[model samples]
Target: MIYAFLNQKGGVGKTTLSIHTAAELSGRGRRVLLIDADPQGSSLAWSNYREKANFTVVGMPKATIHKEIDLLAQDYDDVVIDGPPRVTELARSIILSADIVVIPVQPSPMDVWAAAETVDLVREAQVYKPEIKCCLVINRKITNTAIGRDVRDALAELEVPVLKNDIGQRVAFAESAASGSTVLNQKLSKAAREIIKFVNELRRLK
Candidate 1:
């Protein structure tokens, strides 16, 4: 299976979610390949910092990635793409190549507002690949905030399926990223549990 984590807006935690997803999938014993489709190479840098041997990490930030991923993906059981931000051509290519597109939105007014374009792109992709599955996930949500509480209501206007499992605004995620590790390293932590539940929900979509 191929899963792409994307959003037009930056700092919404797309790379963090994608990295954790790859790590969780690797923990499940699947031969995972994390494709860094973002021109910024955030995932690549994360992989370089950690140097973990659990999965393969490759950089393929081209717009023609839909054409190239097939060959490279053949060797892996699952491919997780960390897509680029604000590049429509590349975003379209990633959407076309993925079996599932997970859009991570933070519980912020700006992030909620920015999701429309990404949703529109997904709609366009579905016109071509009718079987492609997509869903929105709340990421970096601040608990007890009014905007956070109302984010779902705001996102509802976009008419996309919002996953029940969400990732909170936690320092653990940033700490893990800085060290090339993931919340999975601390299984008992809330951050790890949230990611586990999120990934499990994704599996059911298959």
Candidate 2:
């Protein structure tokens, strides 16, 4: 399976989610590969920083990713693409190649509004790849905050379904990412548990 983490807006935590999700799957003994489709090479940089990565991480910033991904997918149990933050040909190619697209939306009105463009691209891709699943996961959420609740409610008005498992604004995420480690490497952290739950939910999707 191939999963693409995408959102047109930056600072929405797409790279963080992609790296963590790939790490989680790889830690579970799945043969996972992470493709850094973003021109910024965030995922590639993270992988380079890691002394040892359980999964393969590559930088493929070309618009022809849709054509290149299939050959690469044959060797891995799962492939996760960290998409670029613009509605460009590269983003479309990533969406077209994905089996599932996870859009990370921050808990704010601006973020929600920006996500609509991504949702639109997903819908357009679905016209061809009807089996391609798309969902929104609220990233960097603040627990017990009214803005969080409001954001969740507002997402309901969007065309895509929002995942029940949302990631809170935890320091662990930043610390782990900076050190080229994942939340799963931490001993009993809430961030780790949240990521595990979200990955499980994604696996359950047909």
- Model 1 per-residue lDDT tens digits across residues 58-151: 9999999889878989999999999989999999999999999999999888888889889999999999899889889999888888988799
Q: Model 1 RMSD to the real structure?
A: 1.0
- Candidate 1 lDDT at 172 equals 98
Q: After superposition, how far is residue 176 of candidate 2 from its true place, in Å?
A: 1.2
All candidates: TM-score: 0.97, 0.98
Residue 62 of model 1: what lDDT?
Answer: 90
Best by TM-score: 2
Q: What C-alpha RMSD separates each model from the true structure?
A: 1.0, 0.9
Best by lDDT: 1
**Model 2 C-alpha lDDT per residue in residues 1-206, reported as the tens digit of each score:** 89999999988999999998899998889999999999999999888789686899999988899998889899999999999897479889999999999999999999999899899998998898899999999999999999999998999999688999999999998888787888888647899999999999998875
Worst 10 residues of 1 by lDDT: 140-149
